[model samples]
Target chain A: MSNKVHRRRFLSQTAAVAAVWTAAAKTPCRALAANDSWGDLTGRLVYDGAAPERERLVVDKDVDCCGKFDIRDESLMVGADGGLMNVYVYLRSKVRAIPPELQKTVEKQVLLDNRDCIFIPHCMKIWNSRQEFYIKNSDPVAQNVAFSPDLDQPANIVIPVDTDATWKFNRPQRKPVPIACNYHPWESAYIFPVDHPYVAITGEDGTFTIRGLPLGELEFQFWHERTDFLETRDWPRGRLTVAIRAGLNDLGTIKLPPVLFAKK
Target chain B: MVFFSAALVVSGCGQSESPGFRINLDGYDPAKVSQAQREAIGEAMEEFFGTPDVPRVPQELGLDAERIAVAAGPVEGRADGAQHGVYRQHCAVCHGISGDGAGALATTVDPYPRDFRLGVFKYTTTRAGAKPLRSDLRRILLRGIPSTGMPSYAQLTDRELAALVEYVVYLSIRGETERYLVQRVIDEGEYLPLGADVKEEVFDEAAVWAAESWAAPEQNPEDTVVVPPPRPEYTPPQRAASIERGKQLYASKNSQCVQCHGPKGDGDGENDLLYDDWNKPKIGVTPEETARLARLYRLPAQKLRARNFREGAFRGGGNPEDLYLRVYAGIKGTPMPAAGPQAGAGGVLTPEEIWDVVNYVLSLSGRY
Candidate 1:
């Protein structure tokens, strides 16, 4: 074939493929619309019985101790027994019935201010479809804003003095993005972006409450940034599964296991 | 032809014999140039000199022109001349036309430009009560400060430097004079009369005026100044109660301390993840990410957590009042939130709550 004719044919074939992909992508949203009822999924994150764990492990060895390393009074552990906090518990499968009023409230823009060289809320959760958020720097100094997502493209933005900036993520991902300010080396924050709005950050007492859950029996997934990932079949590191019902339900205590050490 | 030749010979002999020299001169007379061309040339000359007026002594114009005379001398004059141009081009943008350093730029530069009006320069070699020497100003001009937008004018010549120094001093004198006049006006409501021959007697008249002013109907001593009463010290029980209340509020649901700061009060909160504004991994987090996390949450590092109370560096403060102050005042340049009601210009917490928060934080250090 002549070069011009070949180019024309290639262009036509590429356009046809793109049209087919766009049509296929819209099908999932339509399917999700049919089952739009909200459901409750409750479970406790527990550490499986295993070998003794190391407490307050210093993964980064370069930090010099101003004094002797002390772990006894440290608040590393959460719950009454000091377990990990911020263990996200949510349904593994998709369930769609969200109330119209609840949806509106959920859609409100979440504000994260970088004041005095620290993120106001250390941990935040937003629905997957939520695209934009306000990040402000109230500090007199400049701060670097970096986000590392497990599945999507990461972004690094520089927040100038006394200025506010915004970041938007179009795709949905289940993992939390670790954030840190480069100018203020010690400043850090976390952002959990997911398709569902069933996530909650654990409070100071190492407790999290997710209210307004719909009535149903559902399997939930628990994930913490500090602990290892857990699967449905194998409830690893700090994972759990439970059946949630209508009304208020408290998932018993969740314990975070200590870090595993290999014998030399 | 015979007579003409004879005459030429006679003239030549006369010129040679008399020892007179004569030369032919031929060229354009610049004086006859067109008026437009002359004006254009004059403008070009002004542009070259960087100023319209020829340099002159300040004393000739009834100004304290000592500095100007000194600046025009060979050693300092050249430097001052170069600096004068720089001052006009850059410093005058803010320092003002008078060199009082109260230029238009003063309104924009934070901590405002130095008011040379006082002739008191900070960041100088001179000690307190001493005036900065010429070299001190020169050094500042050469090396610009970091973190500020001031740029160094190291390219100026020595003459320019000297001229600038003199001009600055001239501005200072004028500014001080202006201030003195204003002060005199404020004190007496007008310029006080000074008799040509009066000395000690002038003070007697002034004292009388002062007494009359003090007793005047419009004057009230209390209106000039007001002082607040001192705060009473808290009793032991009061202190204990405040600390207890503070601790309760800290662990409450609203504060949410445990999430990032671990339960034991260490900095290892469960959400201690190293992320950036974009939710990406921060650059080079391999070495000190965890320590950074602890610092962010205001948690004492593991090593510091076990230290004796005396050995630990108390960042917020040791005593309840000190802690309260920290919570109330919020560290000026840190992320530690001000727990006090009036921490920032418009803080959210109430004064009582700020005290409670301070008491609670101090309790964490085992100070109760």
Candidate 2:
């Protein structure tokens, strides 16, 4: 059979070329607008009630390797000061102006290590469709990362001891995907993959900062593993639309009520 | 009066007209997707890709409309001595009229027949995350998947095979497009009577993107196809050494093939609760939700078993090269991870190491 560029390919390629040309034509104007409007989003997710005691997960298998460390359910973590940890906050839209620093961040590899039979950083945000996700197995026991993304392909890979592997998603996910190890069922983590860099995960102190966002009206989503969506006052679907300013936009201590975490 | 009208209509026709494509209800959220919205989606799908009796393809998709005609409609010998309705005559029984994989005998099989709606094929010569080449799909039709109900249609002529292959592609694209439309409706909370704007927006990206992926192999065969290096010829001792190396790799923590495929090469592995991409969705986050989701799906979620080297019936071909590809690409949509080198990145196992693993697998099945 003769090699021929299919019609769809031809159309898409021409469209891409046109897009590049147009982008080049307007680069100066866009650069001015971007630099003038770029800002940051800083916030802390705080649990309204007292800190809930985390239940220690039972580690029955590989006691010498896995049970050496005290493993606890990282879901719904609250610090002494009522700061909630591992809350995901991200821009709702797929398309946005990506700053140079954010573009560079996509180039660097993000690590998800299996240390002491626990997935390090229980929650993470992969900020681009083609971002390199590095997976390392630091423990001695065998671990398999069941990376299942709804829109993209799912991989259940066996990452052996002291070895690391890199994975990249072809498509940005609609929602955060849960990665788990079947061997150690308790070993689980969540990853949010988006095409834009406007995402942040809360730290142990419940703090997160997403810098260099294009100033304008933008919608953001807050999600947690325990509570499906961090539904605050009047923010349905945990989505909050805000008009960003030229400087730091501080959304101080957004309190989460205990009722949101109640299980039926 | 309604019953009388139905009876009259049934009596008037010699045979009942087959039902149109049923939208995959599981794809939608009942709370969000209204009955009217579903009807709208169904109508749009029918408009883009016609009914089973008379199919149609959008010109922009660049699909082979001629082959679709040969495969659709009632099974009959045309005046030009060509065959029609080849799909219904051969495939619809298991794959269903819409290629949803819920035909008459679908539930009877242990592992359900593939639902082409997802467009995720497990076995292919293509690399990970890439659509299979035309030759890959042909290979499946020629050599039927072992240990499954899907049978080989080798008896069919080249023309018949081509028609069937194109028809399958057509059904996959149509099914995927329908899913895309449904997702958009649910995501956007669009009301009934979907306007022309929605159709155009969906067709411009969803359908066009799907068509591009299906055409990728033909357009960029070099990038899509996974070509294994030439197999090393070994003397008796050399072959033994390769198998030994493979056995170690299989058992070692580096590859950990023994974790799922047992130390004895038996299917019984440590982790028994393994599920594929198809069944994984049916499993909800909570046990209660899992029960609810399970009831909604066609079949109960089935656990996937690691292939037993002792059994030796590889679902993908039993050739050395096939085994090489399996280890290299990993079984798509399954738990088997790609052990071979990927594009611009190294995998868990090197080419030589994968070769060793293949030799060990062959030895387990007494192929060596």
Candidate 3:
């Protein structure tokens, strides 16, 4: 259509839209910004076949500190009945606009304690941008916490013995990022920064519940620490596109086969 | 009753203002063009590109520029020159207004943002010596380089990213034209005046060159990327001896790796203040220009950090062949010099020696 014709049509429609908007704006439109009523997404991502055996690590570098404890590699964690831990299940919805309501729900601080030369949480999930991390070094020896995000500049801060520092991630990560201690190469953890609040990390029991997700056809992706989300995503056990309704949406017992994962 | 009545009477209303464009002679001085030639150039540009507030080329060419304007308009302080706010927020801080890779935070960054004026992009899927594919740009926009300050704008809506990509192409073309004009003026040895015919020809040729870089790929098959030969897997004995040899080579003055990567492979080399290809200092720059460039870059001279091997986040993948390719090709646009056979006489390391160095570097991170 010509610009003149398009403008004319637009003007006429504008008046009607304005009147409708004025009427709609009388009631609170805040809820429209984000989901007011939220449902829960619950699931247990477990190993499909026989669980992979834990491999012994060669703690050749820091023998004095690292040798005190026999550390098994935490790359793959499996429990009774093939329960999996350290698996990140988060909403893959393209809606990046953080709901103001959800924004208010961010925790003041998530603790990451370094005790016995290991990051407390092997896999961590930051809900929203509002939250910051408090890294505490419980070990007597000084430890460095180095984060290498593919999207942002890498940061390595040395925390003196028994001291703590506060850090917050400015950028959101699409793929899971690894946090390694240069001094202790064996100490590795993963950080999955999601834009939305509906992200959860599996516990030792290998179960997770993502809370307060908006009602819609929400897509979720599963990621493990070693899983390269950039290359292939078959290990995510196929995508989950579900029409979210009120109350609970149980994905129930998802399986991750050992073959697809090339554990480092 | 209200909902039904509203539905019955109304369709979507009001005009969302279409996006606009303004073409500037990127990285070129206006003093070279004569008054008449300048006027003619301006008129031609006006015909080709519309005012910043209202782009006319898309309308004339039946292109849809508005539909592709950023979905979330100009978040994170990025904009395109004065008119394009989205580019400034995300890209212009590193890639300057003229796409020169010299912006407020340009020099502070390692492997500086690409100077689109040269029309060279390092990471691309379209083989060697070809303009990067739009998909390649999109991938970088979405994924972002991990080790750099470039963060992923994956959250950006599809339309927003597509619009940004188009703006980049526009800037590259503009920069290329500016370069072409400057070269022409230099060749002619003329002062303050170029004939209108020359100006027109130069502008037209530049546009064709820049435009063809994008268009020709559609018809012609992409040049196949050269794949490196397979690396030999080292046995325990070979691995130890090779690593020892690599250590000796690294310490040698000829290797030059020690100069930048340091004795411990900690990245604190003696010559830490080196420039990458993108930020390679050039002559013919006036003191005023240098000051202006510095202000634009907002940094003290920063250099690319030699990869601290112990803390391994290899930018070009971490596989065996990936490391070999890196050692062979060296990282383009960075201070890291390539040591491959194809790197010419300067490439002192033999293929086996390069492998040995790669083995040692990998062993530092325990990857080997």
Candidate 3, after superposition: displacement of residue A181 in Å? 38
Q: How would you encode candidate 1's per-residue C-alpha lDDT over B298-331 as one tens digit per residue?
A: 1122221211222323432354554444444332
CA lDDT of A26 in candidate 3?
19
RMSD of each: 28.5, 8.3, 23.9
- Models 1 onward score TM values of 0.32, 0.84, 0.41
Q: Scoring each candidate complex against the real one, what DockQ results?
A: 0.01, 0.17, 0.01
Task: Please provide, for model 3 over B1-368, each residue's C-alpha lDDT reduced to its tens digit, 9 standing for 90 to 100.
Answer: 43542333243323244222222333334453445444434444434443333334333222246532431123222333222346755777688655677677876777677777656565554432346667667877887776877778998777668877776766666556655554444323232223455435655566555666655444464332335556677688988999999888776544557666788888876555545434433211245655544443323344457778888867655666667766654554454544553301224467788778888888887887
- Give the CAPRI class of candidate 3: incorrect
**Candidate 3 residues A192-222, lDDT tens each?**
7656677788876779887666766777766
Output the better candidate (1/3) by lDDT.
3
Worst 10 residues of 3 chain A by lDDT: A17-26
A-chain TM-score of every model: 0.63, 0.83, 0.78
